[model samples]
Target: MSTPELHWFKSSFSSSSEPGDCVEVARTPAMIHVRDSKTPGTSHVTVASATWESFLAYVTE
Candidate 1:
């Protein structure tokens, strides 16, 4: 699917001082889509929702 078709949003933890430097994410029922805010639509990584949750838990800890 195209990036535009997805509703992308910047992470709340993203640095507001540098507007261009951030991570954007989109979501589906079973997948989490991630991409660089600077290079939208060019490439992205898709991961299972469970995996994304795990990653978040790891990092937040």
Candidate 2:
């Protein structure tokens, strides 16, 4: 199967003062994709939608 199109974007909360310290994210119905902003095309991590939500909840807490 072909890969789905991803709309990658960096977080507004990122600390831009530090180079390469930001992360980018992309979302699909089934998964949430994350990668380092500095090297986005080189590597990424994908997580289940539910797991991504849980991680956000924990991080925001």
Badly placed stretches (over 4 Å) of model 2 are none
State, as a TM-score between 0 and 1, how close model 1 is to the true structure: 0.86
Question: Which candidate gets the maximum TM-score versus the true structure?
Answer: 1
Model 1, which residues run further than 4 Å from truth?
Answer: 1-4
lDDT of 2 by residue, 1-61 (tens): 9998899888766887997799889999999999888786697999999998898889989
Summarize candidate 1's per-residue lDDT along 9-29 as a digit string, tens digits: 997768899879999999988
Structural similarity to truth (TM-score) of each candidate: 0.86, 0.83
Count clashing pairs, candidate 1. 0
lDDT of 2 at 20: 77
* lDDT, model 1: 0.89
Mark the 10 consecutive residues where model 1 has the least summed lDDT: 1-10
